[model samples]
Target: MSTRFSGKVAVVTGAAQGILRGVALGIAQEGGQVLLVDRAEFIHEVAAELPQGRGTGFIADLETYAGAHAAMARAMQLHGRIDLLINGVGGAIRMRPFAEFEAAQIDAEIRRSLMPTLYGCHAVLPHMLQQGRGTIVNVSSNATRGIRRVPYSAAKGGVNALTTALAMEYGEQGIRVVATAPGGTQAPPRRVPRNAEGDSAQEQAWMQEAVQQVTGSNFFKRYGTLEEQIAPILFIASDEASYITGAVLPVAGGDNG
Candidate 1:
């Protein structure tokens, strides 16, 4: 693998599992010092799995601004500077049609999907501004155009807007903001389920519909692998994408959402 991240310090939120876990490991392999953040205690285990001294897992409820600020503060204390931040703390908690979603459920979905990225960006900007350069890679979803996840779609839409607006606002200050809109991805079962309650048959059927929509919308008619999604995110974070900012690259098999 390339040592594009040599001497860099990266902060990866949602590093306990899924795409974020892959990102943390990738950064370590590429010679970056990584601070992995998640509310899950398993985050420490993931950190320990990294090369010695290259990973430090931090547990923080990034859904809140205070937690986000604290996590970024810890990153600075541990590594002295943050060169990159990958916000990956989001997923569709409940997959069902828009009409079926209760007010509380819709609110929960937005909070789960959008708040972490918002708080993370708010907290990390001052540090990057002080250093005069940094990169932020947000994990968005192409489900922004799919069914049974209207709230999730809106939340990711917000993320895309945030990426573009931040890039425009801070590009001259040497910070690059970007995102990747991934399609359905095949990965190991979640160590922590997005929803602990049992899914009703109706819910399951709705979820299946959403899944079908995801794959069918893709030009390849298939879900992507973990690596496929991670590659573009790391590329945008690396100096290789120095001239790229304010862009949302679709890693969705040409879905372009």
Candidate 2:
């Protein structure tokens, strides 16, 4: 309802699915020129759903530096300048106890939950600095403090560190960097199942344990809605939060982290 982003160009990664779809649409609805990025071809469909929308979709593997670089470059080419960036690509891919995780699984968890935010922030910094100002909102998780996916927790912790350090270092240059540590969310069922690891009996138990920990840690004992999880992210990206940077706001139902 607030056209705070009118005329702004926003690039949202992981826009192909889940709560990100809602985040991307919220940006478009607020009058930002939406550029959706995801590895899925269905990202184009998401772009098409924007209001007054001529969807600009970029297909990229955000886990790679080259992919992050290319998405930023391509968006700049099409829209001329990026006013906002929502680094929503990362997530916990597999849930398992720390010792039980295979070497590759550990590597995969780090890549899935940290590298994209790193690559994205790294890729966009120079350009935003050149333009004199911009905002970046990275999606982190409350699981950073709890869970079976220790690798994912570490990765999100890294994201939290990245957000604070970048904001402090660049605030004088008018750049704002922030992150949202969302609790469990009422996410739509994955369109493409993310890492089918729950098939085995032990794996299912691990996954179940992880889920219970997440919910139990929260006061509400339930998942936040898509709106509840993403509103703080969008708020931080808007001028309404112009002075708020270097902080990771917890969107969980009172998890103070």
Residue 142 of candidate 1: its Cα lDDT? 86
| TM-score between candidate 2 and the true structure | 0.97
Error of 1 at 60 (Å): 0.6
lDDT of 1 by residue, 1-257 (tens): 69999999999999999998999999999999999999999999999999999999999998899999999999999888999999999999999989999999999999999999999999999999999999999999887788999999999999999999999999999999999998899999999998878689999999999888888888899999999998888888899999999999999998987
Candidate 2 colliding pairs: none
Report the lDDT tens digits of candidate 2 across residue range 23-65.
Answer: 8898888888888999998998888888866358889999999
TM-score, every prediction: 0.99, 0.97
Off by over 4 Å in 1: none
lDDT computed for candidate 1:
0.94
Q: CA lDDT of each candidate?
A: 0.94, 0.87
